[model samples]
Target: MGLYPDDIEAQASAIITTYRDRGWLIATAESCTGGLIAGALTEIAGSSAVVDRGFVTYTNQAKMDLIGVSAATLDAFGAVSKETALQMAHGALMRSGAEVAVAVTGIAGPGGGSAEKPVGLVHLALKTRSGLVDHREMRYGEIGRDQVRLATVRTALEMLAAAAQTPA
Candidate 1:
């Protein structure tokens, strides 16, 4: 069996097929979801042609150092904010050879939540080298850590598929 559920695998397969057909590559910058998004994409055979790299930037330092997320952005808005998500996407796009990049930053937790940014809150962003950017904020609402991460993976795959299909 694969590492993810059938539904997620289906989405990942679709993404891989779509991008591969277009001769495009993908990169991922993940925080709360860790590298699960990348793992899901790579689960599909032939994904190496479409997926270039994934950054598992679980810490603020890694986000800045690895993907080039600005320290000013992190300090102004916490890691879970939409700003960070966008920057992560931008950074991943800038740093990688991929034409399209996706990023997720969130509090997927049994803990590490606050009044403002609670558990199951995720911010996702997608960027294309052609300058298309899309962002989504999902509040999955107290789902278990594993559930939240899986949900993020599913969403990221969907975004990649959509971006791949969009006319450049």
Candidate 2:
């Protein structure tokens, strides 16, 4: 009922607390979820201590320009693929002061569904400066656009927390 639901607020709070305690920062590279992941994290007070920046790269050009996702990778794997997600996370990590970064690229829609790449199919990647890169593909299957986006945000928050807890 708030800006973010209770579960999202809890997850965001946990991630922010853990990262801040570890003296770590986080950056987000977001596509279909736009900046919702970043928004959720920053919604918690004292987030400035842990959130470095967020890249809302909703377009291929924006992905390349903002986060350095390679054009070749985009051409080959499409923006929604695990490859682009990894590149986005890696690029965000390399570009920002954050020790941890998470990237999301997906087709969250009522119109962009295909047999191979349907709506609600999301690819997420998390990268740490200490050389850990994790990727996950989620198939939510025709859920509404808002639902898919929110799911991606929740998953991204989970990833960030997991990465922060992992030994660097």
The lDDT for every candidate, in the order shown, is 0.93, 0.93
Candidate 2 backbone clash number: 0
Those runs of model 1 whose alpha carbons end farther than 4 Å from true positions after fitting are none
User: Candidate 2's C-alpha lDDT?
Assistant: 0.93
lDDT of 1 at 89: 98
| Residue 45, candidate 1: alpha-carbon lDDT | 96
Encode model 2's per-residue lDDT on 1-168: one tens digit a residue: 569889999999999999989999999999999899999999999999999999999999999998899999999989989999999999999899999999999999998878889999999999998988899999987889999999999899889888877886
Superposition TM-score, candidate 2 onto the true structure: 0.98
Candidate 2 lDDT at 63 equals: 94
Model 2, runs deviating above 4 Å: none
Candidate 1 yields a Cα-based lDDT of 0.93
TM-score of each: 0.98, 0.98
